[model samples]
Target: MTDQDTLDAPRDGTKEARLVAALTGKGQTLKQLSALLTWQPHTVRAAMTRLRKRGYVIDRVAKTEKSAARFKLRGDRA
Candidate 1:
């Protein structure tokens, strides 16, 4: 399914679902995620941790001098 389709699934509108959708593509920074969910950065990170525990493969890209850290959702664990 397309990225947008995933975002619009039955769980659409939930913060976690939106976070998954945002990470479905090119990935997003913590700031972006927080803004989208209207949550604090730490709260977003906690939610990501919860997703990881639930078997979602969330990859974190280290921050570089040029940009902030980025997170991408690589789907569930095999």
Candidate 2:
């Protein structure tokens, strides 16, 4: 999993793979994703950055203050 071929999907790597998988298919919020992934928000952000770079477009939609964030996916290619 070099930097170049890092897709947002679970794409064959063990590290951060589950997090990316949960995010891509489940549309979990940042907080929820953090909890589910057992990762901090910053870790989530870092993983998300790598995911986005690999053609995974994630939109951080602001929802209610109390509710968790609404994660949205963008782009034609995964």
Candidate 3:
């Protein structure tokens, strides 16, 4: 799949939610989650994209240039 397609790839909805919840307390980027799960970056990216499209994903990027990004659940909107 193309890069965009890869990002848009499908994943289990509930698992994606769990992943979001797990990442909620702390922020986690797609790369971070990929490294944490030992999965490919694209896999994590895909999950992120799919979750985001479903409105179940939220990411907290660092406000400053030096800070790292994080992942989280987007309030009750999920």
- CA lDDT, every model vs. true structure: 0.77, 0.65, 0.59
lDDT of 2 by residue, 14-54 (tens): 55676655655446788887888778889888988877777
Q: Assess candidate 1 and give its TM-score to the true structure.
A: 0.77
lDDT of 2: 0.65
Number of backbone collisions per candidate: 0, 0, 4
TM-score of candidate 3 on Cα atoms, chains taken together: 0.54
Model 2 vs. true fold: TM: 0.63
> Comparing candidate 2 with candidate 3, which one achieves the higher lDDT?
2
lDDT accuracy of residue 50 in candidate 2: 78
Q: What is the C-alpha RMSD of each candidate to the true structure, in Å?
A: 5.6, 5.3, 8.1
Candidate 3 Cα deviation (angstroms), residue 69: 1.8
Query: Candidate 2: minimum summed lDDT over ten consecutive residues — where?
Result: 1-10
lDDT of 1 at 76: 31
The prediction achieving the highest TM-score against the true structure is: 1
TM-score of each: 0.77, 0.63, 0.54
Ranking by TM-score: 1, 2, 3
